[model samples]
Target: MKKEIAAVVFFLKRLIKKAEKLEAEKVDLFVERLTVALQEKFRGHWYTDNPSKGQAFRCIRVNRFHKEDAELLRACVESGVQYTDLGLPKELTLWVDPGQVCCRYGERNLAFTVASFSSDDSDDKEDVTKKVTSAVERVTSDYHSGSSSDEDNGCREPRYITGFSHRPPYQQSLLCHRMAGHVPVFCGDRGDSRRHVVLAQ
Candidate 1:
């Protein structure tokens, strides 16, 4: 588990560093590729694709280690934004250590991920699987429509996120859509039944 976590850390560190050195449009493209790599890692695959050349992050900051889902929530609050989770995210891959997602405004793209923020972090295996499934559904829906979020106002803080059950008594079965306020960007898997939207909070 430690080795797996370390590998993800290395990938993200490299991604942020490279992304910071590129131009705006190129940065967006790199972010897209980075999102792809993250989804692969979240889905339990070995993702080694580097989006750009190895450098240092200037504007984008990928939190080296997201220990738990709650920290994601904290990051969102710190950023002064609201984010949502996918209603179904498990069908892709379950990440032991969370990763970052990219949110695009008119010209800027901020990267982040969601995790458990509530104190009731009672995420069993079944619960987490449901969350993953929920995420997939939300992103698919957004993709069919579009990411209509107003990008200019969202803060620059590195966003972190997590999915939870709004239906408290039934936490194990269903996931809730809490990030309804922001624009959702969908990233897909090349060959799998899993996909999700990256919302900026």
Candidate 2:
């Protein structure tokens, strides 16, 4: 019984020593990784598409207007409008219209006279034109591409060729611009439903 106890004690000492060493190594690794992360953050070179990079593509802004306000605008703009929750700040929803004129980015801004609009007419061609034009302008400006055409079929073509284009730079610029108040399509996941949730968190 004495020998058995001695043996057990000896084995336990060795195990504890190994565990301590492992703990020390883990701490060292953590410190090293944290240092690298801090440097990257300060340098603004930390973004990556890697699932582990921890980024998001959504921009949410809170407006003073409430849902009722939005609804009022909807009624004035068009009937049969659709509004959906954006999971954003207190009072905003996505608005859509079927008959609205969709403006492409970088298109010429159009001016409309209020005299052309009547209370009975629900078509807000002027508002649609402005919203689309603004969205397109913001996208183009962030991407640094040339002006978009106003031709009937004018569409902003992707500047980069597939398989050879370096997309990180362009994507980063767009991301930053979106963060800086550009109204862009929210494409980021809200840290759920995928292994890549880190990118949106």
| TM-score of each model, paired residue for residue | 0.22, 0.17
Candidate 2 on 128-158: residue-level lDDT in tens?
Answer: 3444444434333432432223223343432
lDDT tens string, model 1, 1-201?
Answer: 223333333333233333244344443343344444334434533333432212122012212122223423343344332323211111112233322222222122232232222223343545434443444344345433433333234565434333322234344222223333444443333244433335545
Give the winner by TM-score: 1
Candidate 2's C-alpha runs over 4 A off are: 1-121, 145-196, 199-201
The per-prediction CA RMSD against the true structure, in angstroms, equals 18.4, 30.0
Instruction: Give lDDT: candidate 2, residue 74.
Output: 34
Q: Cα deviation of 193 in candidate 1 (Å)? A: 20
The whole-model lDDT of each prediction reads 0.33, 0.29
What value does the lDDT take at residue 48 in candidate 2?
A: 26
